[model samples]
Target: MTRYYRVLSSIIVFTMMGIGSFVLSKSFAEDEQNRKGQPIKSREQQESKASNNDLAKFMRGKLDASSQILDGLCTEDFRKIISGASKLQELSAAESWRVSTDVMYRQHSAELRGAVKDLLNAASKKNLDGAALAWTRTTLSCIECHKWVRATLISKG
Candidate 1:
């Protein structure tokens, strides 16, 4: 039963990750298409474009770190798991991660930090089961936070 549960959990996590990745890729493609259709930019537009580019780069780094964690989980590589978790913690502390001053946004950030802590603890103990569970939690936190961010942006607009 324990083994069955673990396998099921892993499948669910992977499915969620796949869906998230697909959505993100589609959104990026749409953004690129829109940019291509735009006319020449003014000074302010150019600055905004630069800022958006930086944010996109930062987000890609976060996704890479998350992928590392997934890889580690699959291979039972504790070192990779720890390294990835640490990278996530560091990224979460960056100025760019704090995209909003809203209370719910801060709560979401805190949830991610808590999930990362759990992941690190599991990795330190070399507990693959625990680490896998923590990874799922971490991924869910990220998905929820991103959903909230997108909703907030749409509402603001």
Candidate 2:
């Protein structure tokens, strides 16, 4: 009976060890697979991407508003000019409109804002000539900024 009990105990111990080894090996393989898989982005990176998308949407709306200024000028509607210029001024100061740490970007933004302000002032005074000049300045600033931004992005990539 003693011999039989010893054999049974040894069998049980070996079985338990084998089971433990299998479990540990499986866990290690899963860990390795995870390490080899696509790296997960940090929370801040994900949030930043979402924020940028929101900023893009806001900027598109701002562009539409800027174009309205031209339409207003074409129609010679002072009220539309004031409205469009006011919208551009407001967008210029918006958080979503600010997406860069570059000094040049900020300078261009300021230039555009200033041009819009001039447009607003001219329209208020019912000065068509001044409004036309301001609108021309605003359009040029937009083109310059867009070109610079495109070049910067292309260079980086």
Candidate 2's C-alpha lDDT? Answer: 0.88
Q: Pull out the clashing pairs in model 1.
A: none
Tell me the spans in candidate 1 whose CA falls farther than 4 Å from its real position. 1-35
* Residue 89 local lDDT, model 2: 90
lDDT of 2 by residue, 1-157 (tens): 9999999999999999999999999999989989897467899888877887887888787788877888889989999989989988988888766667699989999999899889999999999999999999998998998898888854784
TM-score per candidate, in order?
0.74, 0.65
For candidate 1, give the lDDT of residue 57.
Answer: 91
50-156, model 1: which lDDT tens digit per residue? Answer: 98899889888889999999999999999999999999999999999877889999999999999999999999999999999999999999899889988996589
Model 1 scores a TM of 0.74
> Which parts of model 2 are misplaced by more than 4 Å?
1-49
Q: CA shift at 122, candidate 2, in angstroms?
A: 0.6
